[model samples]
Target: MEIYRAVVARVRPLTASMIRVTLTGGDLPAFTSTGVGDEYVRLFFPHGPDRHDLSLPVPTESGWETPEGRPTAPMRTYTIRAVRPEPGEIDIDFVVHEHGVAAGWAAAAQPGDPIGLNAPTGLYDPPEDVVRQILVADLTGLPAVARILENTPEHIATRVILEVPDKASEQALPAHPRARVTWTHGGNGHSPSRLAELVTTALPGESDLTGTYLWTAGETTALRSVRKHLRRTLGLDSSRFKVVGYWVPGSDTWTERWEALPATVRAELEALWEAPTDDLEDVTIVYEDRLSNLGL
Candidate 1:
């Protein structure tokens, strides 16, 4: 939960839908990367009408805290696109859109602009014996997918499935001798997503799943369906695959609904959140079911 302050060192647009911002200085000298491909960090920026009043949160033993009367900073999660330890630089690739807190900031970011980031956490972990890897994502998850491909062992064969809004959103990904890529146009907020269907269909037969690892990330609702298929239908173990939700279609509305819940009902959900559990998948399923039951 430590917050490391930094300043924008460079800014470059990688594609029509993606922008890369490089950060350096401040506590970056102490920042450490998990060295995992799908690692990500939370970024905090000034929250105001103009968004020029840069106010960062204070790190605490339990988490981070904002001073009383100070507006909570706008925060967004982003993949660690690349990191150069020697120069203490970190690159975060942001998905550009017409409207979004992070996208707006990244679109106008300039060198020496102050920003705050926390330690990174990663989810992609292929078994040592993994023979084949399947990576699936939309544009929002493209940065992590690209990093995953770059980190894959040369001996392992990889299959990449990407869904982008259009041809303009597509960019050259890292090349691998044994890698194959399949791109599908449409479904990056411009149209209905077919990521789940595409991934499930592109997958090899059940008999071919042995020694295979699957990793996917994209819109929350889409990935939820994919998770169900992989777990219940395919009976894949958590060790064999990783699925993540990058964004939600109407997150602002979701947040408002959450805040409007009765105090007692909210307390019940908070208790569930505090309940200790070792099985993440089971816990997630239960939480989602509870949310649905409560009409959330």
Candidate 2:
């Protein structure tokens, strides 16, 4: 666990509403990654009368912990879009939406501005055994989806569904012969081809899913709904999919919402949303034991 200090070296617009901030500094040599494709870090934004230097927390075994009585810095998590060792820089992409500290800062970020970050950790990786893939995302998950596509094996069959606000929001992505990407755009909160519906339509029949994996990110409600259908309706095993929410829309109180889901739904989506890991040996054992008992 380590905290990093970076200076914004460049800002580039990826799309009409998406921005990329490239950070580089001497401290970047110490900035490392676990090399997992979905690795991410928390960017700390300085605030309040007592703190404005963008002071970041020191790392401990438990994680980065802030000291008591210091004004807490507003922070948001983002995926590691690119890591360049030659230039010693990392790229983080931001999709501008409603005003918030992270979005607002990115909207006006300039070269030489200060930012702090920690950890590029997550449990997502291309499954060695699975040769078929499905990727579903909203605007927030576009960067992660891009990373997965660029890194996954080229021979595997892959289908991608992306939800955006409009055509202006679609950006050019890397190409793969086995991949087909569809974009759904709307001016409203979700497009007509919403994440849940598009994923359902793309899921293969039971007989076709032997070597398949599904990765989903974005709106919590849509993602949870998809997870429920995949688990309870399609009877997909717990080991078949990996999921996470980019952000909960319109509210910061996520724990309250989690407390309200039906126990069964919560049980299936909870751990993946909270702490997904690529080491499925541990997860597979726990789930296999459970599945066998139910004759699955």
Q: Which candidate gets the maximum TM-score versus the true structure?
A: 1
Clashing residue pairs found in predicted model 1: none
Clash pairs detected, candidate 2: 123-277, 123-278
lDDT, candidate 2, 1-296, per-residue tens: 78888889999999878999999994788877777667888898767433237767888998877777665678898998888977799989998866778888888888888888986787575557888988888888889888888887888888888888889999887788899999988523544437777778888445467788888888755565576667667777667887776776554555566566568855874454346766543454454344334332
- Model 2, poorest ten-residue lDDT window? 287-296
Error of 1 at 160 (Å): 0.4
Q: How accurate is candidate 1 locally (lDDT)?
A: 0.86
TM-score of each: 0.92, 0.82
Superposed model 1: Cα runs more than 4 Å off: 49-52, 204-207, 262-278, 289-296
C-alpha lDDT of all candidate models, in order: 0.86, 0.76
**Model 1 over residues 108-220: C-alpha lDDT tens digits?**
99888889998899999998889999999999889999998998889999989999988888989998999999889998788989988977896634746889999999987
For model 1, what is the alpha-carbon lDDT of residue 232?
74
